[model samples]
Target: MEISKGQSPHTQPNMRTAKVYTALESLLCVNCKQQQIIQNCESFLKLDAQLRNKRARELKVCLNCLRGGHFLSNCNSRSTYKKCHRKHHTLIHLEVNKANETIPIPQQIVNENTITNTSNQTNSTTNLSSSTLNAQTLLSTAMVKVNDTEHNSHQIRVLLDSAFQSNFVSEGLFVPQISSALPTHTFNRNAIEIPPNIKLADPRFNESRPIDVLLGAGIFWSLLSVGQVKVNQLILQRSKLGWLISGELVNQRFISDQTRASFFSLNELDHKLERFWQVDEFTSNDHILTNDEEYCEEYFRKTTTRDEAGKFIVKIPFKASVHNKLGNSYDVALARLKNLERRFETNPVLQENYIKFMQEYQRLNHMSNIENNNDNAFYLPHHAIIRESSETTKLRVVFDGSCKLETGLSINEAQFTGPTLQNDIFSIIARFRLHQYVFTADVEKMYRMVWVHPEHRRYQRILWRETTNDEICTYELNTVTYGTTSAPYLAIRCLIQIALDNQDYYPLESQVIKEDVEYSQEYSSLPSLDMSQ
Candidate 1:
């Protein structure tokens, strides 16, 4: 028999082959139990290459068999029989198409019992169709429920759950309740008041007590309250005997109305205060001697004698202590004087009457004193003479030990040269005067008492040596020595302290200066004299 146009050889029931084909011809759709003719079957193929081989081996099965539509024992025979019948029916349907005659399957039965049964089956199919419907029925049901009034009550609950999960609530939302439970009070702002007496205590009050008294009270309070300035200890123990009120109180505030009036009235006090810390007029000069003619003539006549050569040599007591400490013979001091004359030849000031007196004194007594060994007649150079005695020793040691004179001349000579120099010298002299009266102090072993720092000690070393065990030992400074950068500064520091300690009794009269050293007392005033004496 010839096969139809759309049929493949695999579709023929008698043509069985072991090779499977995925084409439409090889398929037998078990759903309708029909041969998969080329016109009736759909192609079964994998879209991806990876699944192609697996899909080729996959056996196509019917969905009805998977759902247990037929008895398992009779499935094979039934499937075969259905396939044959379908093919025959399709062929008949096609042949009838040539005659254009329409034929329908028996969808209705004529028997009454059969009609009832068909109705039941129809109802059953309707139910089955309802079960298989898409999401439209579920959506309609949900819409009806949402329209109910009872469902609106859940909206707030849903919103709260969403907010909680999102964590949008503030942390302090509940804190006020706890704090409110603990305390309950209202502040009466109008009831609080400041007192009139306390208002007077304010520092800004214009009509308050005199500034000096106020400052004095403040200082007293400060001393008492802070326990730093012990007035009782100061009085009893005498620890602060010479201590003066200085700093702000001494400078800006008045100790009394009288003090204030006095301070403001006079130019002298104003100048002194302004220049209080300035060096004295006397000590500012490098020289202690003056240019007064009569003074110089008298001093020269008293201190000098002429030699055969008419050379004037100074005559003044040259103490053994001065000679010993200076480590120089009398001849050296004499030579130095000659050199000084040569060096100062052009300085008219040095040739003033006072200096001339000194020159005459030297010339008159020089030869006689040297020959006769008259200790009182022979005068030593200022640099050569060392002050002795306990009082002078201590003062000299403290001041001269640290202070270096200028290289060219004695402190006295330098002082007479200029006003500024005079001021500095006077300042130092004032300090010394203050020290004498206030402290009632004496010099220690002077030069021997001065102690130089080890680092600076080398600067004071002398070339001379002493023989010890027949071996020479170089001489080094046994005490603080002059002629170093730090010396004058150290001396001024000591002098200031001494002046402070003695301020109460013999307050500084003038400032002092050595070379460049200067000292001034900011709080200095005229001390009351003991007129009864």
Candidate 2:
């Protein structure tokens, strides 16, 4: 008791910590007011967390040894809370006073149903209160680690629901893909200072980005730990996902009147959800092609031609007339490359596969080093996606044609997202089962086989470096870049044209290529071995 009550911080670390916390839990930042390094405050917070953890051990005093001679944090005794799973026991003492005094017991026990009703009322109250916002209250947003199909944890931004309500997610959000882009979009960090050694769930937490997931009741509670720190209105809570920050910001400019109106309600979110599902990626012959698509088709037919090698050469269908307005994208692409390097550090095999893919791309004359810079060039940001189930390739390079820089310009944005011209996947599968002998074949580097016109090759420039020590070099992709929106259309349309040109000579084969092949993948069935051959 005397040791804990010591006046000097050197005697009792808790005394100093108590003072630091009291000063921190204010409406404004004390460190900022004193013109000190904000990081110093964060450093102190780390120290505090470490100290608390150490103290937690001491706090778990042996209950059975209370009447014993010496004090110990833990013991061999098996006494515990059972539910907590920790080596500590909680003793609740109830006092029975005079005969007239009754035991302090609740009138009713709150079951799951009663608590659920209370939650409904709480949500209703919250909704009612949300109409009038005198001041802004920032909700807890975190970066949670979600496992992909390959068991790799991808950091996804999620809302930490303190209210412990139901989770809201669009269907098929969790369908693990081989790879996906990060920071979907970057946001501005307005005077926000994060401490060193503290890994945030989302590195760009202060920035305004779309919330990818919303964690509810059970998950929200499970994510919490005993570690927490407060900087003025901003409070950081450590959790399983990482450190989560909530409360208002110090900068008023961060939240303006214009942006305040941008917050979405449940109704608005539902409308977005409907629109999200309505945007079909597949376009079949069942629906008439749009005007832009038809124009793209005509452009392909008029400009597209086969060389002596019978290789189809097509130009990128650029819908935007303002090709001159795009800004320099080399730096943006380089940044993404560096990011990819950091990701590859953990998996050397993925890096090797990526390097081989790029090397093969260059060796096949699909891409060439740029000797002269093009006035209208776009450098694509590339990353690797691991598909363990893939028979041909486990790791494939995915170029982000839709990757935009500060200028909000990208290859996909400039070019038309040409219509999906192939038959439905269902139709292809149905036709495969109809034949006695079914065979499948993938067109090896099929997209690479189709060359991009020299005029449009300038728009498909990419940056790459085989090794980290090597200098990054810019190269033009001579082939139809797989990532571009119209590449699929160009590849599939070329096959259709080939079938048309050879229809009279090889009628049956031409017919099979035209009808049965779906974007270089021949998933067809033949009745007999002779026909299959």
Tens digits of per-residue lDDT, candidate 2, 428-468, equal 77788998899887888778888999988877888888778
- Once fitted onto the true fold, the runs of candidate 2 whose alpha carbons sit more than 4 angstroms away are 1-160, 165-287, 322-326, 372-374, 389-391
Score each candidate by Cα lDDT: 0.27, 0.66
Question: Which residue pairs of candidate 2 clash?
Answer: none
**Tens-place lDDT digits, model 1, residues 1-533:** 23333446557755544544454443544334357422232332212222322232243322123212333343443332253343122111221222244322222221212211243322211111101111110000000011111111111000011112222211222221211110012222132232222211112211111111111222222222211222221211111111111111111121112111111124456577657655422322334444442343344346444347532233222222332232222343344344444434554443353244333333543111112232312122322222445342221211122222223222222111111221344544465455323322223322222344333233233221111123322233433334332333333434443444556665432121122133222322223444212
Cα lDDT, model 2, residue 374: 46
Q: In candidate 1, what residue range of length 10 has the lowest lDDT sum?
A: 135-144
lDDT of 2 at 145: 67
Each candidate's TM vs. the true structure? 0.17, 0.56
